[model samples]
Target: MAALISTTDTEAQSSGDPSSKRGGWITFPFLMATLLGLSITSFGWVMNLIVFLIEEYNIKNIAAAQISNIVNGCFSMLPVVTAILADSFFGNIPVISASAFISFLGIFLLTLITSFDYLRPKPCETGSILCQSPSKLQLGILYAALALVTTGTAGTRVTLASAGANQYEKPKDKGSFFNWYFLTVNTGAIISATAIVYTQDNASWKLGFGICAAANLISFFVFISGKRYYKHDKPMKSPFTSLVRVVVAATVKRKAVISSKEEDYHHNELIEEAMPSKSFRFLNRAALKVEGDLKLSGDDSFNNIWRLCSVQEVEDFKAVLRLIPLWLAIMLVSTPIVVQASMMILQGLVTDRGLGPHFKVPAGSLQVITIISACIVIIINNWLVYPMYQKLTNKPLTPLQKVGIGQVFTILSMAISAVVESKRLKTVGNEHPMSVLWLFPPLVIVGIGEAFQLPANTELFYGEFPESLRNTATSLTSVVIGISFYLSTALIDVIQRTTAWLPDDINHGRVDNVYWVLVIGGVLNLGYFLVCCWLYKYRNLKNDDQEQDP
Candidate 1:
């Protein structure tokens, strides 16, 4: 991955220069600050979106959750498109800058909507007979704001990570950056989930959204201020096109005889002595020398890319294909967590959330437990657990091992949630409702799972993917999360329509059954993940280990 750094860094280092104007630790503060601001702004609204819809729009509990899931999906999915654009056309800085401004615009619009009575439905008590839904014009304005916010958030999310990682030339430095990056993100989330949410609940929604808008504008400027100091990767032609070419070339030359000789296969100067791997022999045909395949003058380039591809290109496509099963398995694991998040909010609403005589926890702020737990787990793993494990085993845990451990935690969290919800149900109408403290254990467990899964998955993808797809690689986890959120929405809808397990009023529904179902799904996902881990081979394990070694 360090090899992906620009040649300027290498040249400066070789010249024994202590100061490189391009990129180094100097860019750290600016990038971290930018991330912190963005995280705070984005989470302010995202964490409380379901409640906002239910309270402000007169949306039913189930419908509000569904809308939240779709919003979450957009938050994750649009990044892949932005990442592709960054890697192929605009580069990261430009895309991030544009997106940040867009976010500001959206949040500002949200603030306006909150401040004005005309922009939302009339406020009505939950389950009221005369609840009024928003008119089409009002809905249109709200959707347009959400669209802008979602697009901006998705565009900046993964692209910023890739850009930050690009600034460092060492793997250890890159790893440290990611660690700090997530910490900063969680810290921002903590602020948003707690302080901002409290303000929204107790003070004013307009003020909370105003703060978010201000943060977005400030972060955009902070990012722009570092423009000259950052190391920028120039955009190249779309690498996705090359992957398609490999597939097309292989299909075109399907009947070509497999070659034993080295010269018969196409090789660029970088892999001149490399032989095609036997793992995916059929793909090797794409790089085989065949009739009418023309070579350009004095270079390894091919004139007809559709008919002939380099061996490296074929291998890159194979790497992507090999990742599918593991990706799907992880997506399944994440789906349950997504469902649990929305469920937690609904559960908190009907439970006792009092912390003391004068204070009550905002339902949306319950997610802070997860973020706080993840932060603590990350700190411990970085400073204690990972070091001890590496010393005892003579090698650190692989990303796959971390993911497996996370899957177990995920299952445990689901089971715990089911038990807690069951207990809550028993006391639903009693003089004393179930205390929100019971929600802590499951939330913390899921946070620990995330600490293991999210970073490990990001590291795995970034390390193994082809260099050309580095930005896209970073966004792969986002793609999984996006799809999982969508799946969670679909699953919730099915459950609502198919059974009495998830009625519009969760108080009347068996919410524990939903958690139990997630537990079963999580166990199945874990099984699938383990199988994929057993069968899959790392393309760059040795290099990755050396780079990751502390």
Candidate 2:
């Protein structure tokens, strides 16, 4: 998604009018408003979905968690596909508009499902022997609603982020926009996780989903209203084809000796003076000039794309390759968090949720703590921590350093979760259960980690990739998150099948052991991330003050 914005800016600059009236801070308010509405709508339904499945659809606790993970996986993964559509066929406006409408329809359907009794299974107590599973027809309708919601939400998430950032030309302003972007998002999540989830738990699911539907509909209109203020970019030919050509050209010329002379390599007008970097020298063959590689017309264009590529194209592909290790490490760091999100709900259900005699905390609302924590952390980082660090060190925190801090917090969160779960297991049979507050420490830590990692990752990827490939770079984080959620689902399934540690009833299972495993994995992932950071060379350094290593 970040890539889409960069592509738009690059196109604007190439057109010799970088200061066009189509984009600037003037568009900021509208984009932020649209994002806020969408955020409220998205989180309103998603945060409580596990509970919805368990209570309305009569799903098993573990099955509901797995379903929740799969849904989240889709939420993260679909952005990549939609981003391509925005970049290749439809521009961001059409894609975002259509997606928001689709999201409204999905949420509206969910509202209908909650209103009608026949649309879901008969209500039953959690873990009851007489609880009935949803019939095939009911399940089908439910799944259809979920599918629409997932697709619609996925399309809008990253697209909106990209669109918002596209309004600003300067990198510093872009960075500030991201900070506020996430703050707005987390603020909306806080509303949904508290107000919306509370409505569902205490008032009526129909009304709660109705609110979500209205928010989505309103957000669609809000986005449409701002259409005139946006800096719209025309859809470009898919950049991926050129990347593939580079790989193909390199393979075809594998036996060709790599050239040191700049004249022997093909260079586009934009980079005529640029020579191939010494690293990955074999890939330089892709740009090496050979007899018959050029067309007889004497134009710069190659006769065969599979046999020859420009130097820029080769380097673009190499940039992607270099990012792979860090990408995997970050993905691994996120997987445990995915696991924790689902598992926390299960833990909350068994714990004492009574805030007072008048009110009880909803299990789903436990996630709000993490959201609030992340929001607070973001505020502190922006106002105090970052300024203080720069004052003392004479440099702002680099994205890689922020990511490393996130990894450390991730490990800490997992260890804390393990300790909390172990203590909770011991008090399982007590007349008074453990307070739900016990879950707060780990959840808050997870939020803090998110505050550091997610934005830093976006900044890192957006800054490092080639301008031609920038459209794909930001979407890489979404891909990582999507894969992480799927991997979390797989891990849970594997645990359930092979070990007694995760039985149907969590009260009798060893969830602490699961957290311990995640803790170990988090440590290993941190080490791997550090190594990647050390080895990586920044291709698009924003400033000399930024450090090269984490």
Candidate 3:
């Protein structure tokens, strides 16, 4: 580790020389450009997807939302697999570049679907009693496009963050890069949600999808062009494999007596000597250097499986075990957020979207309110709220505390959503359309909750997890989102089949009841979260102070 740090410092010093080939800020633009182009391409289709399904394909609104949820879930989840591949096999640049090409192909195929007639179902005649559903062939083509796009977006999204952070050795520069990365992401989202949605709604689907395809194509090349300037990390075997190995080895040697002496464990020469934590004592058997477990006198002749492991390996596995409950609790927190996002689009469809006499807002674009609010809140919280709190209290709010505050806001948002939805239902009678602005308060509240929870949740994982599992740690947020989305899909399906609350036509159904369910669920989940927070101890409490660096 010292040698690695020395090399990085040397590279940093040499970066000032005009002739140096590596290590500087020159790669930032390339990453930003790649991110911007990809975000535009991904969000262009995703944000407006429900509208497209309802308008062009004539699918039921509820079904369309479910499909969107599934796609979003896939989009979120695929990053886990990709991040693992980057960290354990292929590394970041290759995975990102390959994903970019896949994305381009996906969007390009979508453009083709829009430009051609046979690729999609025939347009339903106005006020037709029986609209023609898309054929199996058409559905197959569409799903293929969605799969490629989801996989592509997932691969590139988080991997780029890792790649960018690798360029800088200092924590401060890395933190600053992350801030700008998120800002670029939001910027791309706003543009795609507004401009691209408007183009698809008012102009032509072909043109809009074409623009997305073109952007993706450009992004692929942009990333490849910067390959020479970027710093690259070599892929190594995943720590997850070692964790699993420890479990298997410990179980095989269950009858073996554990040892109290430090010398009884196989300590890696490179790592400093330390006793294993007593919390998960059973796993300590995995590291016990019993007779025949090692060949200390020989070269490359030691038990590799079902026998022994290094002391560090056992503790790493235990750290992961400790985090599982907290991870599961947070999954519940995200489920309602996913459910609300899916439902909000449907609500916007029914609400009066007119801004004035001449302008009307697109239903799909309503999410921009949430996006804009979250960005603003993130800025304000970091720049004003946190500092002020620290000044007043003489100590900063811990990550867990921040997340707990987020839980409160989440509960409030759900309650607010339920009330607003009830009001909208009441006003929908007598041909009265509730103003779309009614959706803003809940969305803004949820956004504030995100600002609090997301950073804390991310920091907790990154700070607490084993160093070898850093890639996996950062990707955990994506995993939660993915699982929550799938859970939300299942929840919506159960609601549709088991209750009258979520019919195809929400006007005839009790949509407000669903929000009430979320409110109750949010409260329960918040309770679960608080309990987890109480039980959880930070593995690196001092390291967390560095996490606050700007």
Candidate 4:
């Protein structure tokens, strides 16, 4: 039944009947509302997660931090798998709609847990030496809720971004979509960081989580409401399958004689013919037209499926192989940022968060600095930075260059964090708490760096990747983020055991030294990134040539 509906949609879309509605900006409102609602709900819970775990669940601070890191890691990483599923099986609309509903259920369950005493452990009394751990039933419920939420958010977040971009056909329009996409995302994040977080901190957790549940439920409904307007991409068999076939075919044909002639490679009359590039020439054998590789037209036999592939298939695999080094380099650039984000929350917890006599800022709300700075910086880069650079240098900054520049900013952010942390340590025993405002500079710097790199990274992947794998390409950003979150957790654990930098009570620990360590790591990663960037030859030289042509 599901396959029938998918086929109907795909056929309707492919036939190009004038009556067939595909895509337009009319879908923007629904997508934006859905994004906003999900962001508000998810970020509301996630940003304040450590506080919730520590206060409501009676978990220790360090334990709560670790749990939050793990949850975040899952949230970030699961998108890659989900994106693949969306592109391969369900398509974006169904996955996103399903994800929204699942997320709603998760948030609703959390709301119940907050409201019911039996769903949680007994609250620990202040100054108590002994604390009761949650029972298996309670832990099970909590983990189940988290798993659902993470799965839900992971599916929708990056997938929605890709879906939104698919609405437009032109590169400029797609580029514009990303600018607004990131902006909308940051706006949602800012609202969650400030308003939702404040409510969670100052009001009841029940109220905050209840709002999240309501918003998520509404988001799902809103997305469904726009079903008629959305342009749906048909799910295809996984492109990774074809990539594997290419590798297998290449390996099988390794001892065969090489052919330089264009006709030697298989080409369906439908697809334009081109010989495979010399780079990774061994893989070109996969496309070589061995005897009996091409069956007669209309033959239904599956024998040729593994032994032969199109030249484009071989080339696409080669593109991915070339991307590996650049991908690893970007991962290095991301790891420290994740570490800083996790630790910055810890810093905020210990520092004075009061703005004035009347109110106090929530520790999680402090991250609004990063979100806002990123939002602002993205605008500036798109409007001012790129144009000015093009005018001055007679060339626009490439994504790789933007990423390299962002690394410098990251290193700078780490340096500033180390310095500020050192000062905070010096004043640790003072009567007044160190002002939370001091944390803003480093956060802003990191945010600026992200503004440059994150969008550029997305653009690079989406632009360079084979048409079939664009969804997976977009999710590569999430992959790095997810890996970095886990790495951050591991780094913290190692620091805690091997050194005294990450004690539960951070005031006594040399947290400054940890930032310094990150600085050193960032510096090394930057060097590695430069090497990768220098070595990488852009696969899409047509765009580069066109830019240089004028």
Top-scoring candidate (lDDT): 1
Off by over 4 Å in 4: 1-16, 167-177, 271-273, 292-303, 543-550
Q: Point out the worst 10-residue segment of candidate 4 by lDDT.
A: 541-550
lDDT at 433, model 1? 95
- The residue-by-residue lDDT of candidate 1 on 1-550, one tens digit each, is 3344445566766686656557889889989989999999999999999999988898999999999999999998999999889988999999999999999889999999999999998899666667999999999999999999889988899888889998999999998998788778888999999999999988889999999999999999999987767877779899799899998999999999999888998887776547788878999999999997775767575558888888899899899988888899989999999999999999999999998999999999999999889888987998999999999979888888888888899999999999999999899789989999999999999999999998899888988898888768878898999999999999999999999999877888999999999988888778778878878888888745543321
Question: What TM-score would candidate 4 get against the native?
Answer: 0.92
Error of 1 at 148 (Å): 0.4
lDDT of 3 by residue, 1-550 (tens): 6456446555765675333445458889999999999999999999999889888788889999999999999999899899999999999989999999999989999899999898888888887757889989989999999998988999998899999988887899998899889998999999999999989988999999999999999989999987767777779988688888899878877888887888878888999968887888999988987776755545567666667888888988888998999899888889999999989999999899889997888888988888898888888998999999999977788877888888789889989999999898888676768999999999999998988988888988898899989878998998899999999999999999999998877878888899889889888887887777777777777655533322
| Model 3 residue 99 CA deviation in Å | 0.7
- The residue-by-residue lDDT of candidate 4 on 1-550, one tens digit each, is 6456456656777787544445668788899899999999889899999888878887877778889989998998899998888888999999999999999989999999999999998888789857788998999999999999888988898889888888877889877887677767777788889888888889888899898999899889999987866788778899799899999989888877879999888775777868889999899999987876645657564448688888988988988988888888888778888778777888988898888898887988877888888878988997998999989987778888888888899989999999999999888889987899999999999999999999889878977788878878888888888887788888888988899788778888888898899889888887877777766777675555323211
- Model 2 agreement with the true structure over 226-297: per-residue lDDT tens digits: 676688768988879898888888888888988778899887877654888887888898899887676655
lDDT of residue 19 for candidate 1: 65
- The best candidate by TM-score is 3
Question: Clash number for model 2?
Answer: 2
